[model samples]
Target chain A: MTKQLRPLMIGVVGDSAAGKTTLTRGIAQILGGDATVVCLDDYHRYDRKERKELGITALSPECNYIDIMEQHVNLLRLGQPILKPVYNHSTGTLDRPEYVAPGKLVIVEGLLSLHTPALQRCFDVTIYLDPDERLRRRWKVARDTHKRGYKPEEVLAAIERRMPDSERYIWPQKKAADLIVRFWPPYGYFDENVDNRHLNVRIFQRHTLPRPDLTAVLDHSHNGRRDAISLEKDVWSGGQPVDILDIDGTISREKAAELEQVIWEQLHFSDQLHPELLGAFSEGARERHSDPLALTQLLIVYYLLTVRKHRPVEIT
Target chain B: MTKQLRPLMIGVVGDSAAGKTTLTRGIAQILGGDATVVCLDDYHRYDRKERKELGITALSPECNYIDIMEQHVNLLRLGQPILKPVYNHSTGTLDRPEYVAPGKLVIVEGLLSLHTPALQRCFDVTIYLDPDERLRRRWKVARDTHKRGYKPEEVLAAIERRMPDSERYIWPQKKAADLIVRFWPPYGYFDENVDNRHLNVRIFQRHTLPRPDLTAVLDHSHNGRRDAISLEKDVWSGGQPVDILDIDGTISREKAAELEQVIWEQLHFSDQLHPELLGAFSEGARERHSDPLALTQLLIVYYLLTVRKHRPVEIT
Candidate 1:
């Protein structure tokens, strides 16, 4: 039986609270059994306590082992297993290392995955999450305080201190990314107190990787759902020409479903992969679905599952 | 600057408490900054508590991430860095991972280092520690109770439970080793109260790699010490044709020094590397020197440093 020669790798890079985990989870869930999610944060050179003592931010290149990260990612890209460390986010300590094997698609999610060219070459598809600063701070405070055992003030302070490293190491990686995904509050559409579930998503598709064409479907599918979906060719950050796809937070369910079908069909395995797992987010105990998140997730998975013709992922 | 294409690797494998660490430490200490020591135990899939819950022995391949180990070893062989996991033996937990860069010589030490051909190929030289079972048991009991936080009875029980795995997974790996090092109490010469530092060492030189010629020195160096050093061609375990070099624990200080000088000359650049680190071992908290161990360690370092001529390891 013939296989894909090597496992497909996708790198999802972003700052903390940039919804990278949420986006990667949706893609993995949508891809079903074909994806393995690896967090690059596990390769931190220093623990949280050690970082504080050393007076270094985790976002700095010096604070992480980029060389080891490159080797491990290359190994996974070649369909080899790696002893991946487990960083206990809640306890802020590195726990036991886990044996991680590559699936047909390896989804590497982290802050500095695209920081190095060596790391960038390992990924078949790359994404950079660029959530607006205000929304990211809000998300960080909520997630860190509730799930990561941090006080809201500590979370805010960390974000404040991480700015220099974020610009030096993180923001520049967007140039290496195939897609730059941004979620932001639509100024007049919602007040400053807008909840996360209603944020609009704009996907900047670069020429680095071939992305799905949604303009034809967009022209016919909206069906009176105002500003629900649109495809526009524009110059993004750093004057890079990119094809942008926007999914409005106020999009109606029926219109969102139609756009989802177009992107899902573009991925070419609608009958094989289920759609129920897409776009599900949690707020404490409450689970909610966002149309914008679902479309963004489906678009990202489109890049993953559609890169090559089907050879039966089961064989790989 | 021209240098060796790859870093030289040495694998020292054995069952628990087989003197792998002691041998590797001496080699690294003798080689000074040119060596990096990696313990295979850090690739364990289950921690001490989890191993107990699962009722699986660490000696078994199932308890360790051998695939990950193979990949990481390959990376180091290419003069690469690895995010190596640090297993805390005292706490019986896997703690923070360490970022380990390959030095000129990487001394990989632990059980199952030579368990597979993939791992075996990574080593330029391989040594297996096969201390006599009784001596090994004594060493394990002493070590586990004092350093590893276990009772003597518990250590004995663990050794008993690990026997099947040791036979199945550990013993067979000796065939892949270039040198089989055995430390034991000489039956007729020593009583049951013989200490660890006084144990005799038998070096089983396999024909896998070109070994140093110690026969010329051994022919005349014995002078007055009975069985102080001897080279004998014999069939070792499983009818393997082996050249055995035996170092008696009771060698005279002058004779041991002469043999050490012979082996030291064979290694080249005796002026470059200091000879003080070879024979040091701790009996409880007291530092002691052993003639047999010093010779055995010098012999291993001879294989490592003499494998290739002076290409200036500093370039690597």
Candidate 2:
């Protein structure tokens, strides 16, 4: 079994407006050619019209992905292959079959990604995105009108209907993460001009402490009580909650340098000339603190820290 | 809006393993005289194997119920109704051209009953069942073996695979409910001889708070916040956690003599001859609660509680 050990798994979770996909894409860029991105949205249980007939609105956790998460995690753990579902954000439709193979880093990203314990067990690291409510709303408006073909009013209505399920399933997942990234305006915060077109990204939580090897942590079989629910328990991570930096989104480019320096120094690995990573961070350099690139860097660090600290114990 | 009031809406929710249909049958026995029980399980997005091939599960909140819930709720809310999809639990198949009109009470029950807020908002009450895990397992085992023609090992494996989704989608629902009834035993509490034949009799969660008038609740238009989650929150019911009760398989023919008197005093109605109210507290008394009376009574009370609380806000 030791002959073919896998690298690790990581999860990025958030609501639709929470910028989970963007955050994941940027992280994948930083991880370079070695990482693979798997979106959980493809597992939706129904299409639009069917969902309408059923009298439901929005993609609540219960509406879909829960079971898919289970299956995907199993496939990932076994290092077996799977034909991942492909989804279209622009059309709000799922595409034909697609598959994914293991890579140096397997990043699972989507709504409710960390919601299940079994799925969570598959992750070496976990990250949550908590964007400013207003910014997120604005993003939704733009995305819905332009991409989803929904009017502003329709989008607003859709959002309202989703709140109950979000509270019931999505938001609570934040409490279980190794890192919680909150996007906020930097110094003289909120002074930055609002750009309805560009959504600002921020890293609210960056775990500075050394992360344990998650594989080792999850290796121990769960002999624990099945129904035991503990708010303070480490869950799959099996350690204290990691302390992380909560960065502001409105910081100046110079401030971004400082943030980047801190992150690089912590890893003790000098940043290399990976054009993709550099490009991702620089694309929104003006607001590097909040751009997708900076957010990605924060997430990558979170994943590395977790993998390094917690090692899954080998079981017979 | 005031001129077009609709019937009260009630939703029944439980996990696949939980005896939702059996519980629904009990409620139907009591309210069937004047109300209609609609089975939402019929609108499954896909069958068992189809769902598995797609790497999804039936319990997903994102199942095809969105459209079904929307259509059904609209009809009931608008004072116009139609037939609902009927799922044959025995055959594990769906039958079309089946629906229930809006009667005095519209009792909608199924796996994702409370999954969607839009659907949930249309209901006057919402109920969830949380039976003993072992009982659920055994019931599923038997059903799969005899009904679905699966071996015990296969059922066990299926159950194992489904747990993640169950925890993510179903268990969290218990917290959202107003009443949570846990069944346990020293055995002699409700009946001297515990009967394992039908685990269906257990009542796990019952929401008993009085609800607003159905029409009045549905009259209020709901427009969710922009960029909010796909989950609904406006119609949430607030109350303490559920209280657990121990009831054996056998119900006593005896009533706490004072219990009847207490119920009469609370209701302030002296109608012993009224069969409906008589069954509320008397063992083997209410025509609906007879034979399997105790279990039926448990379900009726649960059904009543939900209707009272959710009062529909407005018809679409």
- Per-residue alpha-carbon lDDT of model 1 for A1-316, expressed as tens digits? 5665577788999999898888877778665677899999888778889999999988888988788788889888878888887777777787767778888679999989998899999888898999987888888888888887789899888787888888898889988999889999877755556867778988888877666666656865564646677888888667878888887887778888887877766667678786776888877657888888988887777766666444223335
Candidate 1: regions farther than 4 A off:
A1-5, A145-158, A192-198, A225-227, A235-240, A309-316, B1-5, B145-157, B193-199, B225-227, B235-240, B309-316
- RMSD per model, one decimal: 3.4, 21.6
Q: Output per-candidate TM-scores for chain A, rounded to 2 decimals.
A: 0.91, 0.73
Give the candidate number with the greatest DockQ: 1
Q: Which candidate is the best by lDDT?
A: 1
DockQ of each: 0.64, 0.01
lDDT at position A313, candidate 2? 31
**lDDT tens string, model 1, B1-316?**
4665577789988889888777777778665677898999888878889999999887779988888788889888878788887777777787777878888679898888998899998888889889888888888888887777789999999888878888899989978988989998877755557877677889889877776777766765665637688888988667778888888877778888888887776677667776677888776667888888988888877776667553323334
lDDT of 2 by residue, A185-286 (tens): 433445337642223343333243344232321232122342110112222365544433333333345545544454445452336313244314212223
Q: Estimate the TM-score of every prediction.
A: 0.90, 0.41
Write down the lDDT of every candidate, Cα atoms only: 0.81, 0.54
List, in the given order, the native-contact fraction of each candidate.
0.71, 0.00
